[model samples]
Target: MRIALIYPPPWKIAAREETVSYGHDGPPPGHRPQDLDADFYQTPYGLFTLGAEALRAGHRVKVLNLSAYAWSRVEEVIAGLDADVFGMSCWTANRRGVALTARCIREHHPKAHIVVGGPHATPLATEMLEHHPEIDTVSLGESDATFLELLGRLELGKPTSGIAGTVYREGDAIRKGPERRAIHDLDTLASPHTYFDTHIVMTSRGCPWACTFCGAETTWGRGFRGHSVRYVLDALERVLARLPVKMLQIKDDTFTTNKKRVLELCHGIRERGLQFFWSCDTRVDLLTEPLLREMRLAGCQRLSLGVESGSQAILDAIDKKITPDEILESTEMAKRVGIKVRYYMMLGNRGETRHTFQETLDFLDRARPHEYIFSCLSIYPGTRDFHDAEAAGFVDREVFFTETFQELKTPFDASEEDTHRMNEWFFANSGLRIVHRDGVADYRAILERLGDYHAAHMDLGAALYHAGDLEGAEHHVRRALELGYPLPGLVHNHLACIAHARGDLDGMMNHFSHAAKVDPQHFVLIQNVNAARAWFKQGGPGRKLPLQLTVRHDFQLLERTVQPTLPGPLPEDWKAWNAIALPAEPSATYLRTPDVEGSQHVLKTRTRLKVVV
Candidate 1:
């Protein structure tokens, strides 16, 4: 049987530009004040893995990432792959795009078994097939085995009624099955990297901790199932031989859940002499100083902690099963071991309020993470939070998934105005702290800038300053200036932020002066703008805090240019794309990394950098 797996583009910007405009009142459900969640898109490793499974089952499979392609062009791309089955991955953010692509594919091949899988499809399986007649069936969870089984039955012209872990309509009635039994021996399966030179490695099948906001259980089933240390080592060796990637992100739910396995994996890396800087995400309570030190010695350059909120009450409310103290101490441990820490922060959960926001800010000041990744609380199907919200009448599944994101159900405990204020103030002050003390952030931005990335670096710089890494933040902000940023006043404003944070009144005023000289629209130059921005940083509502101003990339051609650049798919010779040094453009988002001056911070990053869902 022939199969084709396609991952659709993430955005509908061309079709919904007018409807997607930013709101001045409050940030949307998907956006943080720092950047739109759409800024990054990664390879659909799930579909690729399924393709690998199909290959092992003696079925032909083709994998394609049409993420950057316009939705209208999906039909054009699908024609290239004439297969008996078409599998598409779905996510809430890209559900509409998936539907559009599915309809086009259906138009071209009416008889093909068009199946949808992934976060969005796994929970809303029956509803998805019901709401959109184009989709033939929705695969429930752990589809590697199910998809392979599906193809064999189809080849034999058999009914799919026997298949477990799938939902489909049968004579006006919907049939649903429990998720497929979890794959115990993960090593038995072929790594997706073999089919596509991917950078993500999932050494585990499920998560042990059930966070209220996460949908891991809905898709992967309950409990943790990690691959043997030898299995992970074998997979790592395979990737090392295939791609020239320097860093491999271990895409696991709480990679440190099994400390014994992690230790063995680190030992395996040393024994094998596989050289690469790797990172993984895990809960704060799972890490120990000794474990972190061992990890660093084994070439783990970074550790990402899901420090979702700073407020202890909020943490308890979300069932994060972690304390604020654990978060701080974990950062200290990772820092002691020379592993840069990246904190994944979320605001506007069940218990969030002005008081909780203040607690979050206070925690940020104390923990001093090397970076802060900000996000707003978002609802997904099948998560505990989603069910609670539905039962409470906060959202209606009838239109929630099919229609435009409803901002009225936004989960923040504070009023819309207060939420807006929190976002703006946190972004501004966070930059001053991160830059002044913590250190530089991950070089992901530096690698991205070598392509079509075009965010204002001052935004990042400001974030860094607030996290307490002033020099690193300044390095980037100045790089932004060197790249001829369209708004220099923002740069001046940020420099002033750094100065003001460190008690340099003269230096603070100096930057503010430069900001005013260049553009009178500087936050510090505008009446009350500086006051509002500094209010959180200085802890006051009406008191004059301090001098404040606010704000807040290039590309190159290669020999045989790669079109629709990074964060998108490669045409061919993708391995070569990963192995070469990238040229820089003056207008691209510039970032300073530990790499030598004038060198691109290359990771041979996956077309989409890998992160756990």
Candidate 2:
């Protein structure tokens, strides 16, 4: 059978890609930038693994990366393919997008079998079949074998009764098959790389850590599992031989979960002289200077660390073992050794407060890793955090459905006003400026108290730019400069935008020159050159100012506080802003209308929003 694997695009946030879903409230307060790109939406690994299994079984296969392409484009890519099966992976965050995509596929190809898989569908298979009629079957956990069996049945026009790990709709009722056992001998499965032209490999499955907010423990269990070192090494050798793979992403929940095993893997890679750059996700506490140095020697170029919080209390609340001190030491060590670090921090956990929130800011001062990711704590179903929130009275039990979980209202440890204030505070002082603060005086006060007004200004400027408020963007940019915010290469580019908008040719040229001088290797400079050429061609001003500016701030403070330091690099384009054409009127409106007495209750009572933006 011919098959098309689909991945849905993330939600749009100020033109950036963000994960938005019906089951959880949007990202935690002040966590992610409005413009985070869609880099994370790569090909779905599960589908690739399943597809490889199918192809090995002699079926024709094609992949449609809907995450990279829109629904219309995905159709175009698969237009001529005579595929009998369509498989889709949907996470809670991308379920809406998946559902919409499924409907479109049904309309375009009514006779094709539609199958759904992934974490969101695993536990809620029945609900998915009942609610979404377009989806013919839902594959439970570990879909490779299950998908193959289902396809085999489809090929022979046989009943799906005996298939394991599948929930199929029989007339109006859903019939679930036997629970599929996870493949223990992972080596027997075909390498996921076979399905794609590129190289990718997984060293392990499951994570040892049980962070309250994470779904890993709930989805894959707390027991860490891995293929033998020899299996992993052989897979690497095969990939290196067949594909021009410049980098290897160790697609593990936590690569350092087994320190001894990771050390052995690194040594093996070194001994083989793989000469490939690699990246992996790890916790800060697990990393040591020696391990980082060893990994660096093995061509490890990037490490994404989940430094969930700077507040010790919040860390404890979420069962995150590392302290603020550990975060500081590990990040500093990583920086010292020359490995690029991406810090993933979580905001808006239960028990969060103004004072504890400040602890995070203080922690940021010392742990200062390269790129800071501020994400809201999402209470995914079956996680400890979800239960904790529900037990603590934060979750509205009535709307918590077994299938298609929903968050009725934004749960807060403080009032909505206080929650919003804390969010603004986090954005202003967390070494990353990516929040909107029009009338958030308390948050601004906290920034001022922390000596971060300059950083706050840069953040506000970026927020305005993203919001398409050009005048406001200019005002904040000037304020950032006046407050003596460090103007990195990206900052200079932002200034050039302002100068261009104001028609100050000399100022634009000067700022652009400064930007080039500071970060000659900046990617924005390429765009600058292109814009200059375009302006000259149009016989217009040699440079036009940008309608908005992007801001970058120092995050080096995190390094000083954490321990057993690891070395790492920061993200490129430290700061950036471009000239955007503003809409004739505000494209989106947010209301701060007065709350009616029973309105809050009613709003809190509703399980799911009729329309999710």
TM-score of candidate 1 relative to the true fold? 0.70
lDDT of 1 at 217: 92
**Candidate 2 Cα misplacement greater than 4 A, ranges:** 10-37, 68-71, 74-81, 198-200, 238-245, 388-414, 426-613
Tens-digit lDDT track for model 1 on 535-557?
Answer: 64676524655443443311111
lDDT of 1 at 306: 90
Give TM-scores for every candidate, taking all chains together and pairing residue i with residue i: 0.70, 0.65
In the range 1-613, model 2's lDDT, one tens digit per residue, is: 6676666543212213523342332232333332222223445567767777887898766554445333344444445445588888877656655666677678778899999988767766777777679999988767788888888888999977657888998887789888777777887888755445333467787887788777775456557888777778877877666433244567688888888888898899868766555778888879888898777666565677888778878888888888878877887676555566777766667667667767776776666565665655555656676676667654633333322322223433544554666556544534333221233343244235334344455555655655656687677677766754433555566667666666676887788787677554334443575576566577664344333332332221111110001101111321111111101121121111111001111111112223231
Any idea what lDDT model 1 has?
A: 0.64
State the RMSD for candidate 2: 13.8
